[model samples]
Target chain A: MKPTFRASMAWLHTWSGLVIGWLLLAITLAGTLSVFRPEISSWMRPELHGRLTDADTATQAAIGWLTAHAAHAPAWYLEAPSPRTPFTYAVWEDGTSYAQHALDPKTGAPDVLRDTLGGEFFFRFHFELQLPYPWGRLIAAVAALALVLILLTGIVAHKRIFLDFFTFRPGKGQRSWLDAHNLLGVVALPFHLMIAFTGAITLANMIMPWGLTTLYKQDFSALTHDFSPATIEREASGKPGSLTAFGPLLADVRHHFAPNGLARITVTNPSDSNAVITFNAIPSVSGVGVENHTLSYDGITGKLLAEHRETRPVMGFYRFLYGLHVAYFAPYVTRWLYFLSGLSLAALICTGLQLWTSKRCHRQQGLGFKLVERLNIGMMMGTPTAFAGYFIANRVLPPFLANRAQMEVRAVFCIWAAILLFAMVRRPNAAWRETLAISSLTCLIISLIGGIPHSPIEWAVSLVSLGIAVLMRYAMRYTPYRKKQS
Target chain B: MLLPLSFIGLLAVCLLAAATPRQASELFTPPLPHKQQILIRAFGFLLLAASFFVGSLSHNAGRLLIAHIGLLGLYAAIISLGCTLCLHNKKRRDPAKRRNNHT
Candidate 1:
């Protein structure tokens, strides 16, 4: 009458995974795409393709533009072009007003590129789900916690995890699905655990804010300030002043922070006498923690003020966890590994969902069974189709259309919604095959529309899209039209 | 460095898989003997350690470890697929074997 430990774990694993599986898949896939955020951003802006400029020249040009356009702004931010990104990202804020522009690295002019979120859409959607602040992050955090639980329960329930580490029996229906699930889960167990745990930790402040509430007591800014204390906080003198030359300051930063180029530049009160300029070092591959090594200079005099490096142990640990999750410091090969591991996690969830439905295939179908079957088909195929739609929208939309970026994102959701509705209306097997066929076609169209790649990143993206098309076509052929009743 | 590590990791995982009786049967006519299985597994573990050692020579040990784990998963999956293909081909080539398996 009582369930054994393994049975309880199995029950928990099945229900928990089924409940949050779709959300986890979306988050994982988005995060995976975010691994190449800069590259994707570059690909989306074909106008900037193959453009290269020295960081100092880009910085000076961006500053010159800002000086002309946003002289009255209190602060200006500049992200210099890097090997992966070919454009300077510049932003200016003046209390109530804010603006951003992608500057041509060579000319410092506003690049006449279609306004799109580019890879940032995927990066933000990973945790935010494109929802309003806090809520989406909260939901993502809860899903991550659920994933950790599901993975742990799965490990407990899978008594043959080690034995089946290298076992996969394809085309055996439920058994094959279960085998694939177990194989993927067991092999990538460490990565799954790390990603889930780190994901939760990344948003732990929101989910578990008791400490913040007790200490800061609604003064969130104070908490943030304490975490990263400003090296120089100077009030604007309001007296007009010209900024000192950036070349020598940049040279000094390079000389001091050798082997690490400047990643970001912040100018506070740029046109005021008390202005401060700070340059942040690009993260190096030598450390697991993101070292916020910065050099500050008096903006008016261009004299070096202070140098700061992250030295606090607690902050170092937190940065380490965050760094692992973001993989900002990852090398080329390591980034590919992260991407593959992310795919494996997504595949593991897919296999688990399919196994749930296939296990009860022979039983009398109930409403719950039907819903799960339809949803599984919709989400597994529909999400990727939606992603492809987003890419297609980027190329197809009018370059200067109003709200073009929002329209592209809307296209993703609309396509996904339509496919979900279609899945519900069509037979389960037919839904799977049709969605797969549609996904394949969309991918093929993307590859063709993308045309010849101008950069290595573009080439990789094009080839990958084409590869997915081929794979989807192959899968479409194999997906059975009718279920074989035992 | 990473390429060599990947090669060694793949070989290591294949050996471990071959030591498993079920997978071994798919790859070999007769499953490997118990003693040989143990030896193969030991060698596999040794190579796996070597891969980790080589990987740790990189600037960051933590990142290297993460990469190593990812590579392990990839290698295991490759071996699993390889074994599955081997079994499928054997069953197709030997009709009697396929008939016996069906029965």
Candidate 2:
């Protein structure tokens, strides 16, 4: 006999959500934090330079510093901040190797800046979890697809959906928990769907570029050309060549975009006379987190050749979608609201997982119930342990260590993996309480140690993060466990 | 599961009342009395419709006025249908007949 449509959808929703719930929870929560990553970084580095610096002076100083450091470098990648961020950061590659540093605002000196890891680490962790490039990202992308399916099935299977919205009847056992879950889910449904869809689309080319592959055919170079028009170089010859100078190029960009600042610069086909120089124009719109443009110049003559602005109909729409999803362009109020909603969504997933385990435990299911109980603990508590490890790595690890980012990320995964493995061996409740307590204490103590150098404001942020960590541990201690019937 | 599911169900009902204002489902679900069902549905519908009208009217006076009118009409239709359901339930079980059934 065929099951009813609702029954079929219910099964789909339950299984789909459960299978990828932890992954989705991690990705979404990390992504929410990443939306405010830049601000957090700024807050973390209070001992750095002041809030503002002159752009022209900083650029010239950085170029001069790079010339002195690596005079015969093949290429220099200069990344100057927009108005929002007033620091000069750059990297350069010579024939042998590449190096990166933040410029001192006053002295314009390199290597003076502290080696404190900033928001970029969080940004990288959000998508890749610091895993090996495309593979980790691929796993996350698959999880996103599963999330989309779960949300769709959830909506379809929800009965009396309207009656459920304002119906948080506490202390009604499963009914109360379900009501809270549904309320949170529906309240943030638009955000959840939008973020998942847009996040998938952000790496659209990586996931499915069939359309591009078909259109561009074997001339795949044209795709890069079309997207990054600024990357075009002069036709090559059998003759050797070398780039002239970047001074005039910088001057030209300054004249063209007077009020708006220059965000970044790219040198294509460097060490060739016919190399291309691209000066990315600063966006005029304030608070829209993205900053990229294409203004190509002749590398030999340093003449402004052409400008390809993508902030138009189709591309603009894509940017808008990304902006909405990331909340990069949002004000303080909207960003906090987004953060709160993301926390609520995490709570919803946690409670739902608990509800499933509780029901199964009551039936005296042996190994299966134990496995679920352990997984719930490992996922919920283990994630915080991993996050604390990341902070610890940043503080203790040598700043000049090669591949520091990767190492910090490895520390997180190792801790998380160990906890998961331990959960499998140990009793669920004992491991849960211990891991939660350890993670909370680690975070709190680290915050105090790492935040002492900064001002009261930074201390407060650290305190808040630490407080949340402790609260989570407390919640774990109170969670009910299975009883043995006499 | 039961707790979260029912909350979601109630929320959906309230939102539907707000969004459509005129569409009411005919099925007698949730094991509630006919009169109580009609009253709750009508109240939800009218309240949502009114809030929508007032909010839009105050925010974007010119265009929202038209929106409010349309919403008001929708509320009227839904409330009427809900009232019909109440009457049908009453007809199904007369008070005198109820006494006989009990006896």
TM-score, each model? 0.94, 0.75
| Candidate 2 local Cα displacement, residue A74, angstroms | 4.9
Error of 1 at A224 (Å): 3.2
**Model 2 native-contact share:** 0.00
Residues B37-58, model 1: lDDT tens digits = 8899899999999989888877
Poorest lDDT segment (10 consecutive residues) of candidate 1 chain A: A477-486
Tell me the whole-model lDDT of each prediction, alpha carbons only.
0.85, 0.63
Tens-digit per-residue lDDT, A1-486, candidate 1: 227999999999999999999999999999998999898888888877545677788777878878887888988888767777767887888568666667777667764766788888999999999999889999999998999899999999999765676888887888888898998898878889999999999999878989889999989668855775645768999799999987888889888777776788889899999999988887764776665787889999998888777788888888899888998888887898888899889999999998898888888999999999999988988888998898899999987788788899999999999999999999888888899999999999888897777668878888888998999999886677245662
DockQ values, each candidate: 0.67, 0.04
Residues A255-339 of candidate 2 have per-residue lDDT tens digits of 7766656878766555556666678766544424354566888766777788776756676777766665666455454555567
Number of the top DockQ candidate? 1
State the local distance difference test value for candidate 1: 0.85
Best-fitting candidate, measured by lDDT?
Answer: 1
